[model samples]
Target: MKRVAIFLSVLMLVSASLSYQFYGLPYLQKVDDFTLTDHNGKKVKLSDFRDKIVLVFFGYTFCPDVCPATMLRIKETLENLGDYKKYVKVLFISVDPERDTPEKLKEYVNFYDKDGTIIGLTGTPEEIKKVARSFRAFYEKVPVKDNPEVGYLMDHTAYIYLLDNRGLLKLIYSPRKDNPKRIAEDIIQMIKLLKMEK
Candidate 1:
């Protein structure tokens, strides 16, 4: 009886540790609601997407490589979702608010998202900073040397944030490590988990 009790206690501890480390429940950060202008020149709030599994990415339209590649990966993730895609929402938030006007954002995101489902967001510098701070996302402006037309570039974090239907951040994925298929599977699993909670 003593051995059985000890074994059960160990098992319970291990199970909880695994759940906390892998599942990101009870301790995951809850994203605060933020309002920003979408590509369509409309004010959009994070709470507006409460019913969706939102994927938030921070990047600029002028990015030479990372932004475009990550956007394509997100597009592929949506494609992989198929019928489940409707339950997901992608928000491409531009860190370069000085250059990424609403019109430019619309053109940029439209190039990849033909269906117009992906929403590109930009806001005033202060507003962008507030939102970035909420996600702990970093971005800095670096001036280009001897570049007359190209101007400066933004150095920003590349992590993709996954928020549950209730706007609670549940996962963070690296474009360099996790592929679209893996992300899609995670989203589907998250959907199942949320449904079970209900």
Candidate 2:
């Protein structure tokens, strides 16, 4: 009984610490460094974006609805940030790197932002799998009867990650929200806090 009680105590403490870490009390597990090719074929390291607030989303280009809608919301949220954009970056990493070649990803990202506020990235299946696992993201392919050549559908986590300038995780948001402006406000607040920290 005493051992069980102690274990529970430790579990609670660990949970609280993790929450604070991701929530900015300085206790979250930082993502391990990784190198993946961006939509432009430029090599990008997760650590390269250091000192910039990054919003990371995992999805594939061919997602029937969720991916596109979430990306649009992300774009809108960044736009809503206004002058503070200098400190923030939006990253869309593809889970289906097998199909999402660098060139194709580049075209998709460009369609959303001409100036390139949003960047798309893809890599080998193994590399992408490693990164996705680190982020605790899950993605699976769903077969379609008509599209046998190209996997018809992909089911993946639809949450967006809000990371501080130092790459510490902060907030998770759903794709379908009543007011995206609220999300923008949260991001703005995080940016302000990060700026103050620096």
Candidate 3:
């Protein structure tokens, strides 16, 4: 019993340490550019979001769990950003553009935040692939027998990438590391550090 208790304590400590690494450190990178159609059918270039912090996620509208959950975390994170909201934008790019029409993406995103703070995007499969490669995001489609529900399911990386004001990569959040409160706190801290730098 004592040995089991000791092991549990050690496991807890390790878990805490990993959590701190994901939310506490500012992991930076230089992401490649992408061009895709926005929810409004406007052609949006990565350069368009320049000079502001951008949180980018790649997922499809039909996603069962991770996508919506991540978006919720993003909304909460923005709420926690306070005045820094003006300096950040959430970009959701769809990998399954074959099914995720521009209008569909728009409605889905608006369902989460109607203020136009989060932008939903879709483009050709090639375009999405380019963006995915740039961000090192993984996505795979598994075909299933004909069903009225989703005929196929996508296994994708459930993550959010935080970019600096200059559109440079700053951090990454996996599903295991994301929560409304944690994401909010992380974004707030990053914005504060960014402000201090500028």
Query: For this target, which candidate reaches the highest TM-score against the unseen true structure?
Result: 1
TM-score of each: 0.85, 0.81, 0.82
lDDT of 2: 0.75
lDDT of model 2 at position 109: 87
Residues 144-186, model 3: lDDT tens digits: 6787477998889888888866566767777787776677666
Write down the worst ten-residue block by lDDT for model 2. 19-28
* lDDT of the candidates, in the order given: 0.84, 0.75, 0.78
Clashes of each: 0, 2, 1
lDDT of 2 by residue, 92-162 (tens): 99998878998888888887887777889999999989999988999987788886776468889988877
Top candidate (lDDT): 1
Residue 140, candidate 2: C-alpha displacement in angstroms: 1.0
* All-Cα superposition RMSD per candidate: 7.1, 6.8, 9.8
Tens digits of per-residue lDDT for model 1 on 138-198?
A: 9999999899688899999998898878777767887665588878877777776566233
